[model samples]
Target chain A: MRTYLDCYPCFLNQALRAARIATDDEAKIKRVLDEVGMMLKEIPLDSTPPESGRLIYRKISEITENIDPYRKIKKESTEKALSLYPYLKSRVVASNDRLLMAIRIAIAGNVIDFGANWGFDWDTEVADTLEKEFALFDYDKFREKLDTAQKIVYLGDNAGECVFDKILIEEMKKPVVYVVRGAPIINDATRADAVQAGIDKVATIVSSGTDAPGTILDTCSTEFKALFHNSDFIISKGQGNYEALSHTSASRLIFFLLKVKCRVLARNIGVEEGGIVIQAGRDR
Target chain B: MRTYLDCYPCFLNQALRAARIATDDEAKIKRVLDEVGMMLKEIPLDSTPPESGRLIYRKISEITENIDPYRKIKKESTEKALSLYPYLKSRVVASNDRLLMAIRIAIAGNVIDFGANWGFDWDTEVADTLEKEFALFDYDKFREKLDTAQKIVYLGDNAGECVFDKILIEEMKKPVVYVVRGAPIINDATRADAVQAGIDKVATIVSSGTDAPGTILDTCSTEFKALFHNSDFIISKGQGNYEALSHTSASRLIFFLLKVKCRVLARNIGVEEGGIVIQAGRDR
Candidate 1:
């Protein structure tokens, strides 16, 4: 997504904060500030409220100054995710159909997002509305199928969300395989993070290899294909997974996620803004 | 600026590359490689060629992902500054004199700093450097003192460079007061930078306000007699300016810039690992 003008100041703030934390020499600090100012001028800004952008900028600044800005935020975000388990479990149990139950479980497993990402709390009012809407379905037949399946594969998004996924897998007590994008940018979870979170111990972690959001099925490794062949259900999270895998003939694939930023996704699922969707593949 | 083992993959390579170019989708690029398998469980072989940290991590990825990361790079890099000049001139002229000679005058009319704060340029590198380096210099005895006095300022640095100082200023061509840190940091030019650069337009740019590198000089305003009394040299650049003036200073300041990673800077400045610095003052 193009950066809004609102984001420009935030970038400056981040750079300034980094300078504060990184240096003590006055001349050096001056030099860094000069560079930061130039950067701000060079980048174009999207039209946005200065207030919102400023807040984000300040937060980024604080993070740079404090060092490891992502870690603390990730920790807090994960706690929020964990806190939502009760609501998620209650909603899933209250669902009318097995499909709804499966969808809820999959969502509660955690959202794997791609592109135009925003950090949102899973327990917010918007999220609650989404859960309620998706819970009104039946997925019992799918659940029966899943019970006999030997393996399940999950694609993840962002970093903190990965922790929540690990929690979901442990609760389900099903053998799970985790997949992620590889070697592209900071902020996304990595194989090291999985190991750090101990997800590696329970699940086979794999790399998609490509940087594009859409899943290129042909790019799947032999191991990934083998797991897919044996699994009865494949739970894909976020829009990227859907965009990539929607054309597949696998009837067992279920997509669970929130309608955060994409118009195309909202149209495809026939939902309005902030909608929660659970889409199952048609029998081929 | 010794890099930590954990920061090498993303920080040195991915993030640097992103910062150098403009891209359309930074977040998408950020999310593309978030898998467990792609991460280096053991540090990659040290034989991997060393790369420019900023170029590797911040530039390439930002451009490839379609994010315009160079708004600041283009604005503050030395290359961009050189283009500001109408003709070929000295980029970083140095001298001990209070006023630059004829050769300096030819190129001194417009200084294009690679990484100064805001967008102000120098008329002469030598005079500008002297004004900044020796704020207390007895300019009356110098033959070029009268000729050096003008309404231009040069700003430089990246990340924490002071861009906002210019924002607060109502006018550009006045007795501008340029501010610097009264200390030194790694790889930062001294007050000599302003003088040698022949920055005669500035009335005074002092390091009195900031004691440490990147420390925000909240009191830098017309109200503060010591830092901004009859001050025409209201140009500050780099991380030092940002650290000292982004919040408390109300005076109009122009900043120049370039984005250089801290670790790399430390190496260039030949300082101990993780050192911080500021510019120098008469007291020092």
Candidate 2:
């Protein structure tokens, strides 16, 4: 979707979050925020919010001189998720409707985002997302699409969340290509991160070859775009992917599995913030 | 308190609130936000958040060409409070401790602010705030200060909250000067709003001779500043007044009767947002 006015402040908030993670220096944080301010002032109203997001994170990396500031945090986050994986897998395994349980776990993992600038306790949020009723559940549609699909592409979001995605990929009976970021950007899973999270064991892993913190089609490599075009079904994860791909006119069957983290995105989708959504992508 | 990193988003949030009030035009709204972005970039790190606030509202007025975007809302808010006045007065009269009830009532009225960008069911918020125990109640000090004071200057915040201030003024035995803004700025009370709220009937009413949406002493008239200086005690109402006057090192004893609104301000005061406070002002 085109950038709404609400996205403007969120851009700054995201910048602040990255700057904070990048350094503890007050002057540096202020300097980065000031730079964010100037960029926000000139951003075109029609551009996608993540397009500007790409700029803000680039600036944060430049000013802090730590291209992958979240590297340590991402490792810690992955370790934390791995520690909980056994219990999570047991819950999914125990459920009579295992496919449905896997979907819920995958969507719950979407909450691992740092780029969204939300602080959440993982266990509570996961339990809440799993137990709470969906605000937009396209379960029957998802099942139907999964039944007929020849090839599937799964988009990955955050570092820790990539591990969680493995459980859902294990449930899928199709050949799955799990797409990760080309490079590090605000805790989004890169090739190194996805491998560390062990996503390589569950699905065919490939890089999107862009560091926009989301799947911006124009920036993706030819190989990734060709895979996207050839895939019969796509599973886009988290709000970043949602923001980037929601406006695409591509007729490929798609499902957006995410927890609504931002108010603007939630409002755009006509749901309250913090609601779980299993939404079918645009068909046109 | 100095502007926090968090205030960057809030600045855009506040700008949105003002632009929405000013007009329905999307282009106009975007223009003001873009302007707020530029202003946020240059705002001093050492200054209070409200210092930049003054610039934002000014830009809103200049771009929208509506001097008082909150004019109709302020009138409606005043009417809403006036409708509840008799019942609220009865509550105060029947209470065992009249001053405490009145103080609660006044702080509750602060929820009526348009500058804070929160939509409220004022009746419910006022009722809730009145019934709820204060997070920071300095009752003994407040009572003792009131008992000892002779000349009193009461600084007002929002237009709707002015009526609630009258209730508190009625409880006080000391002569009071209810100081309002000299002109319109957001939903802040001016002489006209004070008169509309029947504040003139309860106490001496005067303007601060400036519309900064808070008490900026240097920007006020010579007469208001002298009254402010000479007064034995001061009762400052709402977050704007708290923000503008909190840093003052004046010798006059001051009581900040406000609902802590912004996270930045709440952090500065070491309180949670939405808590009612009867804070003692700075002496250093």
* Highest lDDT model number: 2
**By TM-score, how accurate is candidate 2?**
0.94
Q: What DockQ was computed for model 1?
A: 0.02
Candidate 2 chain A has its poorest 10 consecutive residues by lDDT at A245-254
Q: Tell me model 1's lDDT, rounded to 2 decimals.
A: 0.41
What ranges in model 1 sit over 4 Å off? A1-76, A83-102, A108-114, A119-121, A125-131, A135-141, A163-173, A184-188, A193-204, A209-211, A248-260, A282-284, B1-284
Residues B1-284 of candidate 1: C-alpha lDDT, one tens digit per residue: 12222233333223323332344464433332221112222223231212223233223433355433443443343233334332322222233431232212222222332222223434344245323322122223222322354653433332112222222221233455544433332223334343333232334544443323343433233334444434344333333343234333332332212122244343433444222222222110
**Could you give the interface RMSD of candidate 1 in angstroms?**
13.0
lDDT (0-100) at residue A3 of candidate 1?
Answer: 39
lDDT of 2: 0.85
Please provide, for model 2 over B1-284, each residue's C-alpha lDDT reduced to its tens digit, 9 standing for 90 to 100.
56788888788888988898899898999899888888877888777666677788999999998988988988998998899899889999999999899898988889997776487777778878988867777779888888988867899889888888889998997788999988888888988899999988888898899768778776799998888888878998887777777877862368888888878788888888888888777585
Docking class of 1: incorrect
Expressed as tens digits, the lDDT of each residue in A118-158 for candidate 2 is 78888888888889899998999999989998878999999
Chain B TM-score, all predictions listed: 0.29, 0.96
Top-DockQ structure, candidate number: 2
Residue pairs in candidate 2 whose N, alpha carbon or C atoms collide under 3 angstroms: none
